[model samples]
Target: MKYFLAFLIFSQTLLASDDWGQNGHRTVGETAENYLKSRVSKKIDRILNGQSIADASTYADEIKSDRAYDEYKPWHYANIPFDQTYAEAEKNPKGDIVFGIEECISKLKSNKLNKEQEQFYLKMLIHLVGDMHQPLHFGLKEDKGANDFKVKWFYNPTNLHSVWDTKMIESYNMSYTELSASLPELSKSEVQSIKSGTLLDWVEESRALTQEVYNSAEADENLSYRYMYDWFNVAQLQMKKAGIRLAVILNDIYS
Candidate 1:
């Protein structure tokens, strides 16, 4: 069900804060395609019309240009304080990626939405699932999901959030197809391990990684080759795992 976008998630447009970026998100979609069930893949094709998941991957971000979609901005992330569990954390009144993913699953499972909504939420699940795995997307609210935690990427001033979301992936010198192709195939057990978790568990895992990212550098430090060396693999693994986990969910939802 890879590409079928008929009447919805239209021929329109991109990312803001906490976005997982093009290569990262597309890599997740591309990789997930490898694991998708034949039946479910067909359904995805019908729902999305001609749009591949990789293309639908960025629709949530692309729609940011429209004021009508403003409410979805908060759905990109969940930034709780360092010490609090998500349950203990002060919830965003506007909701977060966790809320976004769960709601998408519910609506899709309910099978009550019109054709337009089915396509929209399917696209949403694709994006939010990818975004949720980005450590910065789970970053602290105090730092605007690390947007305020400035760092120089190869002496170019930016922030830690950008570094993980896009910069590091860009430095790897691979297209989404190349990256997805090069990923070592996991054993079924390994895939299951990554998939083995509730949405809340996944969120907590991402939030914990956010801590490591915060600890990676001092604010405004000039990070270059060494930073990429240390963390690029982590980013790759997260994207791969996200793709695998996404396939698992889609199969369950459509099975």
Candidate 2:
């Protein structure tokens, strides 16, 4: 019975963020929908099977997989500042966050990378883009995100990072197309500029936000319901931004 109980707990943790509908998660679907409507480059269309970039919204199913959840943890921690205090992650790429994106992008482009390697790296890329937008993924020493925080989300036991990454986003109950339509307007030039930076820059932006988006509640206490509500809005904004930003980058790469 004890063994079964432990197994149940682990399974719940694994399944908790499957839909990303929880508070503080992103709005990736909404941004991707908006992306499909915009005129995308011909090269990106070919890579996306002759469909425009917007048509690729269906591909989001590929992004949200159990494999991605499992793969994210080790790589996420690889970027945490080990030798220095939490402050170090704020200033440099030495943390796994920046290096992970650069390394994956490098491998994605390398002639030496095999099919399996490419697939692994690509999935990591997709997931990491979402992860970077999760402010807690840019976490400090207190929790590594998973350990220190505690919560009862929609009546289930959970943690902060998991909530933002999968639960909150998945809760929108819209297809990527429907969700994408709801994003705020962006100018072409603004979209192009956001897409121009290296993937490392995106990770750095998340890291920088970690410091500015301060939370004062202690780790052991449940995060205030109000705080989660506000954070969810911020997360949706970030996710939409990320999806559009991702489409822009994808358009340029294949263009």
Candidate 3:
């Protein structure tokens, strides 16, 4: 039984194209729902067959275990070199988070997809919006989004991508609801400010932050309290911004 549980855990991590892990994705989805128009929220409920946005947010990641879903593996991230901007970065022909998000938006807005396709793309959009906010989603191809950039959390061996994706969030011991509520309370103007950007602008913002994330640790360094202190607020802010921007896109689509 113990080995079975361990295998289950390992299989999940291995299969998941995780960004911000499940909790962070759910927090972004839950926060967005708070700001959604009533009509939009009802529409989302119908589209999802009553699943909450928070539950829907992890659908893309959850699907990764299915071999049939293998094509979306690249949609989780966009790799670029440290010194180059996204424009100068070599594009992934398979698609990246930016492409995934844009494609989702375009499909949903066309008003032509069947109900099943609509549900699939909406879930993909929610997940990709959360993914693009995670700085490592724009990380260097050299380290596979820092998964090869090995580091230790406290004393346990892990990779840099795991640190941002789950370590800091899991260490904080918050439920998605708790995490969403703990995020800074924005005024109406602040919420609007977060939603102002186009997809290009948002993608660029996360790409720029990737440099700082790379700078934050050396290979095999032990990351603990100090690491969290330096980066937690930035993580929180990015999730919050993604939530608002997601709400803006959805309201525009279904309004």
Candidate 4:
């Protein structure tokens, strides 16, 4: 078990922002599933061939191993330096999270895609929305979203990107359903406000939060219980936001 865990960590280290690890992505999917309208939920169920959104949420990451999906490598995150807004930052010609997300939304909204394409875009959209909520996913270009921001997570050497992507949520030790059930409740207006923004508006929000995260987490520092305590609430809130915002997008598309 020990050796297997070590190998798992090493494999993950090779991938960047692999998008919130499996649990975090499923939390987003589960939360959105809870909020989905009955009709919209049914539509999604049909499209996914009875797979719950939570089950489908990790498809984008799972495809990473296939060379056919190599073109999607850049779609997991975007880099906009602290000094620049996403609009002012030069876009990746291949695509970034923002571009990927907008493209998915556009494709899903068109209603012209065949069933397979619709399933692919819907699954990707579910995952990317979760990625957009992780502040580090909107990180500085130079560091590749802090994949290079080396740090010690509980004395195990790791980078800032991996810390946020998995360490905190995994240490919390809840399944996605458990975590989703545990999220703080918000009033309807709060949900409305969270869902009110355009995709770019949300990207900017994540960018600002990313700056604060970098300021708080220092390179080479040992992050343990205290670090997790300080940041877990933030992670939970981001999860909630991602889930609600995903429901918002799906509702808009299916309504």
Q: Candidates 1 and 2: which is better by TM-score?
A: 1
**What's the distance in Å from true for residue 139, model 1?**
0.9
Over 1-255, each residue of candidate 4 has an lDDT whose tens digit, in order, gives: 999888766665445247688889889999998788999999999999999999898889877866899998799888887889999989899999988988999999997999999999999999999999999998887887888999998899999988899998889999888999988899989988998979889889888999988987888999999989888899899999999999999999997
Candidate 3 or 1, higher TM-score: 3
For model 2 the TM-score comes to 0.62
Candidate 1: deviation at residue 250, Å? Answer: 0.9
| TM-score of each model, paired residue for residue | 0.92, 0.62, 0.94, 0.93
Q: What would the C-alpha RMSD of candidate 2 be, to one decimal place? A: 6.5
Candidate 2 worst ten-residue window by lDDT: 18-27
Candidate 1 has an lDDT of 0.85
Please give the CA lDDT of all the candidate structures: 0.85, 0.53, 0.89, 0.89
Model 3, 34-109: lDDT tens digits are 8799999999999999999999998898888789998988988899887777777788899888788889999999
Model 2 off-target regions past 4 Å?
A: 1-73, 77-95, 112-117, 154-156, 170-176, 189-193, 196-198, 212-217, 220-225
**Candidate 4, lDDT over the whole model:** 0.89
Candidate order (lDDT): 3, 4, 1, 2
lDDT of 1 at 163: 90
Stretches > 4 Å off in candidate 4: 1-17
**Residue range 87-119, candidate 2, lDDT tens digits:** 454544344545566676777666576655655
Indicate whether candidate 2 or candidate 4 has the larger lDDT: 4
Worst 10 residues of 1 by lDDT: 7-16
Model 1 over residues 28-147: C-alpha lDDT tens digits? 999888889999999999999978888789878878767899998888888888899888988889988888999999999997999899999999999999998898887877789889
